[model samples]
Target: MTKQSSTDEQGDSQSGSARSWWLKGLALCGFLAAIGVGYYFFADQLSLKAIAEKESALQEYRQAHPVLVYVLAFGLYAMVTGLSLPGAVPLSLAYGWFFDLVPAIILVSFASTTGATIAFLVSRYLLRDIVKSKFGERLSTFEESLESEGPFYLFTLRLIPAVPFFVLNIVMGLTPIRVVTFWWVSQLGMLAGTIVYVYAGHTVPSITELAEQGASGILSRQLIIAFIVLGTFPLVVKYAMKRWKGTDARN
Candidate 1:
């Protein structure tokens, strides 16, 4: 009876997993479609040409429709993560040019975390269980190693900025890390890169003409360096704490 019950449970789990994957596939298709449509509609606005022509107009739209702006920000972050897009970092630099540091940092942090979490969910929903069941014996070794210090590795991957955020998300999702842990660790881990990008965005001028006309003051090199330091503050604090702990151990 116990063996029969175990079999029933496994069957139910597999069925639910199949249903989830079907839903995930549909969602993936919809998300890709939306991204393409969005690019088509907003291409002109985000282009350098539009930046040259309608700076104040775009600024006004952003100010008046702050919520809409954030959604666009979220979509941009998610697409970059999902598709492993190449221009994400440069776009981060654009954030500083268009928005103040506070808004830029807040938007990027939330947008990146949300996008990464979505990638994690998408990966787990579509592939994790199937992959595990198919190669359970072979994959267990990989899972065992990553489970021990997954958060640390994740943080390092985020700092490098070379590792695609979505790639990390899907790869980590395939491991044994808990979703709750993934969300919080990813939030903290990604903050460094996000702030770097936001600071870069802080200096971007919306209109080349204004910059050329001497209407906009680009941040001095000194100021940019200072902003970069400010963004690294949390990591600095963590290092200080660790060093202090080491001294205490010696005492």
Candidate 2:
């Protein structure tokens, strides 16, 4: 009777495990489908050229349906970022053009961060285990380093405009960092860059001029200051961390 009971327990456990895997598979499939649909329908519409072409109509619509436009804009921005697709740059600029600096900043900052968090969660849910299985030994050092100073590294990457944020979001998700930590760090880390981009979008006379100028035209004093901060941030953080560690060790 005990052996029979044990066998039944094993079967139940297996069934439960299978059901869990089945749910995960379904979720992944749904996520991919959403990406496919989004890319198919909205990818081209997300570009600067598209925004330029529809600039007048977009402006008129935004003026007429300000609240609705704001809600849709936020949703679209979050969806695009969450999918880890291209065009966040154009979207940021578009928002800047559509709204005032403060509003644009508020919208872009929260929306981008929300989207990033979604991507991060998706990567973690779907890919982290696979990554660990395939590259655990190789990534051990990296994982350890990230565990120790993940926020700082994440912040540094976020501060630099050259580093691609989508890639950063996905890679960091594979680490052992907590979800809350990822969200907050991303929110704060990406703020400076968001402000710069949104402000540029707001200040540009036309999206066509922005496209033609190719981001170089947006290199105003604010951008320069941002660049300077980006340059020095890593070094300063590294020194401070080292000093703190030394003090802790002495204590």
Candidate 3:
């Protein structure tokens, strides 16, 4: 009955595999459903005007319940970033408006990195296997480079705003990079941009102040230029590094 036992074991293995696939599928579907619900319920509330109003209330609440407000803000920022939503910029700006510069920077930096890590993990859990299997040959080069230069590549992407932050988090998850490396590199790479945005938020006045100044348009334009320069800094550095290496080789 050895042959019969072997056949039974094979059948059980197949059954287990099928069960695992079904579970993964169900989990993915649940995640998608949650995202849909979250977007539908919160999208309107996350608009700039809405956030500005919320900031006023948050400031008032912070007087008596500073700890609670801080926790809530952190959780909200993490959720927005983790879900690949669109309010991170506004939220960062709000943080600057609501809190001191140093604290705002610290909170935004850690919250963003934490949220990004969560998204990365989710992408790996849901799509990495499928993506790797389908594009194994084509992805071999990327995987190899990632193994050797993963942090540098990730840092470059984080510094350059050529790709959306959320997209980067998800895409990188499909690679073989270490999660810890991803977290630290992302934190450092995003620091400059975060500083620029937070500084703008901290300094830029509300609608009432803008109305009083009548130069809001000019100020806003200048800030946009500053952001562009900061965003392009990574490209400049990359080019400079290449040229320096070439000169060294020639020497």
Candidate 4:
């Protein structure tokens, strides 16, 4: 009777697991479908050149429907980032072009972080259980390491534009890092890059103006120096932290 009961329990557990798996699969499919629809409608309009071409139209629309435009932009930015879509760079640049620097930074910073958190949560919900079940023992040490150094690792990746933000969001979700930590680290890590890209966007018209005046070379050098400083700031901070720790150890 005891053996039969154990077998019955196992069967029930397996059935539940199968049901949950199918549900999650359906949800994923729905998400992908939504993303496909969004891409079809908005992909072309998201390009830099397209945005530039439509700038006047956009400005007119914004003036005609200021509140609606702001809401739409925020929602679209959040959704794009949450879905891990390909147009974030252009979107960020557009923010710079359309809004004041401070407002653009504020909006993009919060919107991007919020979108990332949403992706992280979705990844955790859809994948964490299965991943843990399949690789529980193997992942134990990795989970511990993430717990200890997750923010630093995340910060490094955020600072480096080589790693896509959406990729980071999904991958980090599979780990044991807290959502709050992820949000704050990502906010700070991505700030410099965001500023650089947005500033570039803000300067685009100026670039054209400068080029017309034959001063493009001077502007180019300044922009290059700014980008270099932004790119190296993280590495400098990391080295300083390491050196500080070494000095403490020696003492």
Task: Tell me, by TM-score, which candidate is best.
Answer: 2
Q: Pick the winner on lDDT between candidates 1 and 2.
A: 2
Clashes of each: 6, 0, 0, 0
Which candidate would rank higher by TM-score, 2 or 4?
2
Model 2, position 87: C-alpha lDDT score: 87
lDDT of each: 0.66, 0.84, 0.79, 0.77
Positional deviation of 169 in candidate 2, in angstroms? Answer: 1.8
Q: Where does model 3 exceed 4 Å of error?
A: 129-149, 207-229, 243-251
Model 1 whole-model lDDT (C-alpha atoms)? 0.66
lDDT of 1 at 59: 83
How do the predictions measure up, each by TM-score? Answer: 0.64, 0.89, 0.82, 0.81
The TM-score that candidate 2 achieves is: 0.89
Candidate 1 Cα deviation (angstroms), residue 94: 2.1
Give the per-residue lDDT of model 1 (tens digit) for 192-247: 66776566546555546333543124456755775567556557755876798789
Tens digits of lDDT, candidate 2, 1-251: 69999999999999999998898889888988999999999999998888888888988998899899989999999999999878898999878977988999999999999999998888788766765676566456556767787677677777764447876777667878899988888898888778877877888888888877878977788778876776777678889999999999999
The parts of candidate 2 lying over 4 Å away from their true place are 130-141, 161-163, 244-251
Could you tell which candidate, 2 or 4, scores higher by lDDT?
Answer: 2
lDDT, candidate 1, at 139 = 51
Model 4 Cα RMSD, 1 decimal: 4.5
